[model samples]
Target: MKKKLGMFAGLVLFVVLMAACAADSSQEESDSGDSNSSGSEDSSAENQDTTEISFIHWRGEDEEVFDDIIGQFEEENPGISVQMNTYPSEQYQSNAQQMLRDGSTGDVFTSFPGTQFETINNAGFFTDLSDEEFVNNFAETSLEVGQSEGSQLAVPYQMVFNMPVYNKGMFEELGIEVPTSWSEYQAMAETLKENDITPIAFPGADIGPNQMMNSMMMNNAKNEDIFAQLESGEETLTNDWWINTLEDFQHFNENGYLQEDALGTNQDSAMQMVADEEAAMLATGSYHMASLKELNSDLELGFLPPITVSEEEVEYEGIHTATFMLAVNKNSEKKEEAKAFIEFLSQPDIASQYANETGQHLTVNDVDYESESLQNTSHWIDEKDTRFQPRYLIKEAAVEDAVLGSIENVLGGTSPEEAADEAQQVVEENID
Candidate 1:
């Protein structure tokens, strides 16, 4: 399984971040209101000297593209220049949090859409972009995910669609059409298992399980106002969507439909099973397609909405989870300069360039995905039938952590009901 950035890549990000750390004293001066003394507030509107601002982000692979974008921004706005710095994923959040808390985070930084972004926004760490012209470029739903309590605290850079990516060739060979209903899906799994083929590659890890939970919630619990009920203390994970989804997952586990020792399998291993023709399907988000293709260039992939637990109420839908919420640090003295960068990137052509290069969908209007694998899922999103991951409604990490643990337990021989009840207890104890 792949883990960690390569040594050379880690060193590059480390050195860049180290240079950014040199601006620490400037943050103290900015926080003290000393930097504002040089120019009257209105002078910026008239004419201002060229200013340099810092930008910090987490994706190492995006450094070159970001630097190119910065270059374009500088060319467009001769008065502002953006300096870019990046870090590996593990160190990114911790360092970004500490820097922001200390009022030393650079002028611009990237945030996530879930609990991490929620915590930072509530801390007043980001400027509100709700009324900015650049914000108007965002898709309505993307803006909704990037906002907190109706305030657009950040701008989304790219979008994600999480669905099952199956081997199209394998399905064709098995004479299996893409299953639209739950029972049909089960039948397909049974046929694969009887033929001594692993029906699906479920990495016994938590992410695929989490994706399953989101799918079930979107399908079966849509009418229940599940999040509202959880918020009001009128419901818990032990009921309805939570229990049924857990049991459905357990059923797949006990029936040998999922590859053995799924709990011990890592995501890359699960994907490898599909690549090597040992399994016919894998549940994942579109973001992994680039990496999967790198592993098996000949792989013919197709996205499928997972079969829901209930066929009576809702039909299957693809899932969309937005990523890379770009925010101007509230404490940065160069916020105006940061906003210039945001505005520059918001241009449809510029945003599409970034999206096309990165294999992600642009959050702004009219920018299409360049990845063929991602394009396979675009029809659902284009038709507005896709759902956001359930985590968007959840603000606590405990919800996911508990649910993933229950999945592991279910695979380890625990009764689905008992395990699900325990999962509910986790949410009950952790709800804010």
Candidate 2:
């Protein structure tokens, strides 16, 4: 009986040992399966190919912001990546033209509206965004730039209008009010001169000022559709609107309304005049407000369009053009990725992000920036009922010969009519 009991105990011990061995084997298999699963996941991740697209623009100072935007986009879409390229603004136009000619440009690039931009857009180098859903995101009238024959060529990131900037402090202290007519503006200039103040520091020495000045004068024209006529060679600078404009330039030069050695004064000196309170107003680029504020934080600057051709003008109508825009390469192999980047740029937050950094305004409707200066400029633009046309309505080369040279000729003692005739001949020769 004792032997049988010992044998039974031995059998029970053997059964418990077998059960422990089976549990250990099952645990080892589970661990091996998990290791294989993890390896497979890592291998899959390594094998995935991300689509890469290139975005080239001319804003060197804004490169950091673009990088941040691109980073965020890549994180959201791990399957896509972007490469950013910055080019100098001065050389961008020619470089872009060369790139188009070579078919070696990046997937996306920046473009403006003008004879050159039109020539490029008409050449089918840029994809049409007219029917894109993102097209509705642009501000009113801002989307018209870079458009040809109802097809939108690029997305206007901002609406740039080059007009005069007045010193709000000077206006308040001297009891000067904003002008609503050509005569009123003239009177204000005369008053400032009488008070021993340089009325306006005109940057006549710079090449761009003339084109902008032409746009300002054209804003008050009796015929605003003059661009179409000018382009078609059906109109000349000797027309009534242009005649009045040339006469106005002569009047400014003769009456000491413009600074002394005005042709010698560059943009920096012109802006400096306003900053030092030696001048009450300045005619410069659209983005000067940020720099002026940086120079004098206490300075209250306000933007003003040209007073109308006459006293009948009620609204401050001017040309609105895209100074910088995003154009997708139509020949891009990664067209889908390029389009995705542009669509991303269409968001209000993205459009206004640069404004926050530099106080430059964006063209997206209802988009706002945190910059106080930008807000103030926007307020004035809205209150004055500003209207817009393509900022690049005329050719830059033609403007240099006809308009800038016309102003210089008038300053050099040529009669306004003769200057106008000379300008008309130049326009007839160079008009696009």
Candidate 3:
């Protein structure tokens, strides 16, 4: 009887011990699973914390410089990433509105000074950046270009002289001086032609003629705000000032001062002609200086506005435009991130880096320019009598197009008078 009772006790103890061991093993397995699950959750949370923003602009040429800046921005901001989107200037000018309307492509975007800015602002596509701290970093003149009414809508990033870029070495070699009067300019062109050099590589295909018109009519117009006058119906495209500008184009064409097939020549080809020393000047802006230098690093360059008026009548020496206005999309999901990226760019050191790398004249104050091209032309920013580009002051695209198209029409064999009349009709149709 004792032996049977002892055997039952032993069996019960064995069963209890087995249950305890099983529970310990189960708890060990559960802890291991929990540890892996917690690690995965942490990794997923880290991924969710990162924000990506899109920066859209028309400066395909500045892609490399911008990429470098973006890389620095990402390093400084570990939680954010930037995706850059660039388009050709013409395509961006035409399609930027449609792309921005959806709010998917451009978390941050750029617009031109007058009509495009007004159109985009009126549509409420821009965030009011009036209160942003970064807004204080830019000059008031630069800021004004981006403002609509009282609200600070955008920030102009580049201050560029929209005048012709000439080959300094070529001019020196030919014993020619910068002209201060229309007659002198004509003589200079004749000399260049005499030397078997194209005087002006005019790219009439896209924005070339429109850009050149800024310098061509700077002093010829009686009023500085002639384009504004046209918009207000106080003047017409058929005004003498407008006709004279077209006639200048005709004179250049007739004199063989422009490149062969000028109307068909694009900006790139025009730039190359000057770079290769085949042409003495490119009827474009200082914004293209870096590009021209890229084609020929040894090329010495300078700005030369067409001096259309007598030296005594010259009111402005060159044209300056505050363009590529940067704005945050009003509907962006990552507004904070987008604004942060802009703020990063607005910093003086960063802006300097960008300016030097891209050879752009930045709107940011006190940025040190290291590029030879920028240093050579930096004096024009303050020392010269530069006027805001009248071409940008036109607020209606149709009217602006008609005005610019008149120059193209004259280049394509139409008389200046006929082109002026045609442009006036289009302007009246659009405005009236």
Candidate 4:
């Protein structure tokens, strides 16, 4: 009886031990599963904390600089990420409004001054930035370009001289001085032709002629706001100023001062001509200086304003345009993040870095420039009397087309008077 009782006790003890071991194993498995679930939850929370915003613009050439800027921004704001979207200038101009309307793109976007700004602002796509603290960092003159109907809708990031870029080394070698009058400019062109160099590589195929017209009319127009006056009932395209500007285009064509097949030449080809020393000047803007230098690392370039008046009558020497206006999408969910990015850009150190790296003249004040071209041309912004680009003042597309088309017509052998008359008729038809 005693042996049987001991055996039962041993069996019970063994069973209890087995149960204990099984419970230990189960607990270990549960802990492992819990660890994995906790890790996954943490990762998901991290992702949810980050806010990604898209910045859309047409300056594809600025991708590298902006990438660097965005990296800095991300590091500073761990919760925010910026994705840059770039389109070609023409494509952006045509499709940006749609992209903004879709609400899936362009938390922040850039637009060209005047027409693009007007169209986009009219659609109420821009967030009102009037009260942003960063807006005060920019000069009032620069801010005016982005204002509409008492609201500051955007901010202009670039300040560029809308004049021709000339080879300073060539001018120095030929013992030529910068022309101060229309007659002197013609003589300078003649000298360039005499030296077997194309005087001006005019890119009539694209926006080149339109940009050049700003400087071409700087001194010829009766006032700086001639296009605005024409837009109102105060002026007409058939005025002497318009006729004289068309005649200037004709003179360039008739005197062989422009490149061969100038009207067919595109902006890139024109830039190449100047960079390769085949032409002495390109009828483009200061914005192309970096590109020209990239083509020829040793090219010394300068701005050449087409002085269309006598020295005494020259009220303005060149044209300055505040363009590439940046604005936030009114409907964006990431409005605060987008504005923070712009405010980061408005900081003087960041703006200077962008200006020096891209060779662009920024509108941000107190920015120290290190670009060679920018340093050389800084006087144009500081000392020279420059008017805002008149080409941008025309709000009507048909009128702008007609006015620019008049230059093309003159280049194609139409008389200046006839071109002026045709442009005037188009203007009358388009306006009230």
Candidate 5:
């Protein structure tokens, strides 16, 4: 009986040992599987960390805001890094043009929406982003500028108008209501002059003022379609509207409503006229509000550019956009990631932050910035039904020679009719 009991105990111990060995083998396999899975995940994460993008744009007040937003974007996207580059505003166009010609520019770049941009697009220098989801997120008009034929060469980031900004205190003190028509504008200028203030403080030293004058005239013209025909050489500047517009420009210059050295002064010096209170009003973009505020935060600044024939409003059709765009180099190695960066910029929060920081209105749909000036200007634009500037209606070069350059002659004392004729000759030369 004792031998039998001992044998039974030995059998039970052997069974317990066998169960322990099986449990250890299964635990080892489970640990090995977990190790393999973790290793695979680490390799995948490392692969994603290699993606990098290079971005470039022109310098403005928004540079710091842009960099901050980019840093945030990089944080959200662990695998991506953004490299930002900027060029001075004065040299932006030429610098971008030269870079496009060389095809050695950064992965991302800036371009305007006009003949030069179209030319660049046709040359296949910029990546086509027509199918991108980001392209669909913009307003129709904003998107139109970036689309060439069927391809999108750039992303539209903002829209700006060449509206008139006035000193509210000055207007109130002079008992002047904002002008709503061309006649009222002229009368207002005269009134301002009578008050010992220059009615319009324009600087013709740089090509900017002439460009603004030309756009304003065309906006108030009877035949707005003549610009396209004139550009193509299919139509001459024989339209009454063209002649009348030129006459109005001459009227402003002849009346001494503009500054004396306007012909020799750039827009910056011209703006100083407003800053110093030598002028009652200055025609400029909404972006100028920041600088104006910086000069005099208490200065009551308001917008007054109207598109109309009388006090009543008229139809408007123009491309009043920033003319600045973000494009991708077609030869970029990191095109996808660069595109993702652009996508991040289009987000409403990002766009609003940028505009608020820079004091520029962005093209983001239904997004509002904290700028009362921008809100007021945008509301005023809608109220007046102002569209894009007519100067942007045609290509830049044609507008430069035919419209912008010839305005200098008019300001220099040539008759508006003669200046118009000379400008017509330029249009004819560029025609096919």
Candidate 6:
């Protein structure tokens, strides 16, 4: 089975964590402030002393915890209130677009801000917070994700990465160490199959799950240059590196190693494969760790960089970023209070609490990570940061999305070259 991210992923299995924590005060008072102003123009404009902050996020079991945290913030700072607006996960992006454009929705909100970030930032919806003091506190990569044209447009709150997770116990029983090279990876898969186990699990049914496959290809193939090359109209996706990675993925699919019904499996079912020990390996991010613990806190998880065949000996850091970040509306009347909340959230105490409560890794330097995998990942990120290669870095979100779409095509029977070509065309036609 495939894994999911965040707190609900774990707590969902037990079914009773919800009932026991229902009466928590801080959790319940956090309001969903979507109520719009009254119509017909008030007979007299009233003076409002309280500053209200609104945000839109995905619905989950952890919302109560979030509200509880916000409630504490409101208590410490009177005359301000947080209006946490939430939407079903399916409608979150679209609704956020409407609200952002509506001018009266959230004064603050969560966004991936990869491709669409430039569009939103350029339209003058988010404030330029480059000079803000909190900017210095964020990891450089987190801040970079939210930067637009030399100015900071958002604050990254969570960190995520896509890599391999292995069942250490299963590997130990097989007397195998985690493979570090492409050759070793193939051998491990073969050995697992010989032992009558699925070597790995993949979910190609939805775009989100399918995206992991694509991201791995991009990372391993070092097609980081492909985005700009195609955008400039000087090249096409028929490049060798792209072709090589697609063929590699094709070989893996044909080998009878991936989960059965792979093309039809969803993330939930795919995650279960790993937990059930039907498969020994799964590809996912650190966020899945919290969920994995819920199923079996004893299940051992490890990460491996996507395999590569590049001649340049590319660095093998996995793809990751501070999770979706919080940005203040530059046009909002409550900028001061919103900024204060931003500072409050970044405090070591608050970040640590969020990490513990949600099981999501944050990018702040203030907190000490308790998880071994997280500590190792942080070290790997530091190494990659120093090398600074453009190839797998995915500097722009637009490029990342385009790459993901192309990967989907390759996974769905289109050749990697063809997928790259289509992606290049899209870049030329859409990106400026």
lDDT of 2 by residue, 51-158 (tens): 666677788877888888899888877767787788887677667766755333568788866755776776778888777777788765667666778788887786
- 40: Cα error in model 4, Å: 12
Worst 10 residues of 5 by lDDT: 29-38
Best by TM-score: 4
- Name model 3 segments beyond 4 Å from true: 1-45
Q: Is candidate 3 or candidate 4 better by TM-score?
A: 4
lDDT of 5 by residue, 61-94 (tens): 6678888998899889977766677887657766
Candidate 5, overall lDDT? 0.69
Instruction: Locate the minimum summed-lDDT window of 10 residues in model 6.
Output: 38-47
Candidate 4 per-residue lDDT over residues 281-331, each given as its tens digit: 889889899999999988888999888778889898788998888899997
True-structure Cα RMSD, model 1? 10.5
Off by over 4 Å in 4: 1-45
TM-score per candidate: 0.83, 0.81, 0.87, 0.88, 0.81, 0.79
TM-score for predicted model 5 compared with the true structure: 0.81
* RMSD to native, candidate 5: 17.4
Model 1, span 332-357: residue lDDT tens: 87788888888888888888788777
Please say which candidate is ahead in lDDT: 1 or 4. Answer: 4
Can you give the lDDT of residue 280 in candidate 3? 93
Q: Each candidate's lDDT (Cα)?
A: 0.74, 0.71, 0.87, 0.87, 0.69, 0.65
Colliding pairs, model 2: 320-389
Off by over 4 Å in 6: 1-49, 59-61, 88-90, 207-210, 218-220, 310-312, 371-378, 383-432
State, as a TM-score between 0 and 1, how close model 4 is to the true structure. Answer: 0.88
Clashing pairs in 3: none
Model 1 residue 212 CA deviation (Å) reads 3.1
Error of 2 at 318 (Å): 4.0
For all predictions, the C-alpha RMSD in Å is 10.5, 17.4, 13.5, 13.7, 17.4, 13.5
